[model samples]
Target: MAIESYRLNVAEVIEETADAKSIVFDVPADLQAIFAYTPGQFLTVAVPSDQTGLAARCYSLSSSPHSGRHQITVKRTVDGYASNWICDNLKPGDRLRVLPPGGIFTPKDLNVDLLLFGGGSGITPVISIARTALEKGSGKVVLFYANRDETSVIFARELTELAGEHPSRFTVVHWLESVQGLPSLEGLSLFASYFGGYTSFVCGPAPFMKAVTTALKELGVPRELRHQEKFVSLGGNPFGDVEEVLAAQATLAEADDADEPDETEQPAAPAFAGPVAIEVELDGSHYSFDDWTGDKVLLEFLESKGVDAPFSCREGNCSSCACIVLEGEVSMKHNDVLDAEDLADGIRLTCQALPLSDKIRISYNG
Candidate 1:
């Protein structure tokens, strides 16, 4: 059987709010015949840069399927490559290659009242749900949009218009942090009083998300009613700075096979000439190899050197061989892990990892 993908024609582009733009696409006659999506599901957009094939990024649809137009809102981030490209280059009538919608962020039923919270650009998916709920006559809806300032608030005008049109059905509040320095929940409390009770959907960056969710719980909100949508998954403490753990593992590995060393243990390592490990330490195991190998990734070189590195989706999809770079640098052919903060702190996905220096130290955390 052949795999399926969705390619779309950009029909319109609307400037939703400052720093955010909404792109509407026509579901091609051929693809629309097979395309169906849940309200909160996200689509991965494949954008090719230079001569290389393409790089993909997932963005949530901001428009309701009931609206008769399929659209997604993208907020330009200062340092993000894909986001910046989309904002500056994408225009009306441009073509976009897309994957079918996939995500479990949408709420199933609309039996109860809903409280929706959106921080900055995270308003995209929440907007979709709120609109869908209204169209389906799904009880009362309250929306709280929090942002750095009014200047950067996305969908502000439309939200305001929506509130005016559905005065009794929906309530909208804007929380300005730049001028107000953290909003007092006086507005939200007033809305809650009208609804009796409601389920909450929240979305935003790490700090913003953590704060809102924490506040909801502390204010005696029920956990069952709270639904959160997060794009990046920083898997627990295992992947965080754990160089000491890697060093300890290397120590154990060294002790185990030091007495009866492998063929490349002594000197003049090997002849493959890929990402050579000048030094290796993990779980008390020590295996040293050489550098200067062409077209071989660090993880590949480690396997060739007889070090069983735990990894999956070597293209950098699963973040399986994610590790802390204790010393030296590595070049990645591609990666989804290691954001700006992680990269500054020297974390890398070992699958796409390539040695930039002759000597490098890594940990499996396996």
Candidate 2:
């Protein structure tokens, strides 16, 4: 079962800044539905690599879903393989292998007021959210974008034009580190106080994200209202056949599971021994299965049942397969995205989840 991927033609390339470029894809009408994405979701691209055959990378889409365009902004990193490859090589009419849109860094409700913070290249997804919310949603949008300097701002003209077109509902505050120094905790807290009621989304360098999340927490903002996106390089090639990738991953997972626990660490609970049952809710539909044998992970089991479960980077490194546990319990073999707060809210990565109880109920509605 190979994951579906498409070869899309590059329709255009726009130089956003000295080190950034936006690649627009020309998705065919037949694949339109498969590529359709919510604002802030990302596309996984397979960049050519001599050493590894191809290097898979996830890039956030900057174009709004309503815009009928698939675009991803890439900024050159000092020694980045994929980013540099994309910026240096891609051109109009070039074809690239790309996975369908996937990711959970999106606003659930466009009608809610949005407080957005984007630092440098992090603006990629934030702009998508702002554009979609402004055009298709009835809510005010406030953007706090930070950059190294004015010249490094990626979408200066477009952002200015958007602000001008939606003057009453859209506002943007530009922060240049060269001019104002790096944004401090106190300053970020003061700014966020003005929109305490709005749903906040932060994507940036690590320090910037930490400051914003800390500020939101200090303001007593609920966990549900605070969202942040963390960028990590994929360790495996997701463009490979899915079964091959899963087989390799299972070998590593088994090796890890065989290791003895450290004396200081608490022992994990035993897994459910017999066949299990599960009830799931997704896209307003209900499904139940009574034959889960506890041998396969949740996502794999669901796929075996012909359930169209949402997933990307099935290695548990992304949140596209996150689901909330409604009843019973499950354990994750590996997780890199969800935090303590997310786990407290019953959010589990379905790709890594294994049965811990006889019966479980989960929902992808959230």
State the C-alpha lDDT per candidate: 0.68, 0.90
Candidate 2 TM-score, C-alpha based: 0.92
Q: Residue 334 in candidate 2 has what lDDT? A: 76
Residues 1-366, model 1: lDDT tens digits: 111455688888887766778888889666764556667767767765552234456788888867766889988877876777888888987898776665546777865678888888789989998888887865888887888987988887788888887788899878898877765555445544454357888888767666666667656677557767765522112222233435676588779978874552223223343444566666567667765374676777677767766553344544546677887777776655444545665767766766676567765432
Clashes counted in candidate 1 amount to 22
lDDT of 2 at 247: 73
Candidate 2, 50-96: lDDT as tens digits: 65677888999999999999999999988989999999999999999
TM-scores of the candidates in the order shown: 0.61, 0.92
Lowest lDDT block of 10, candidate 2: 262-271
Over 4 Å off, model 1: 1-3, 184-196, 233-366
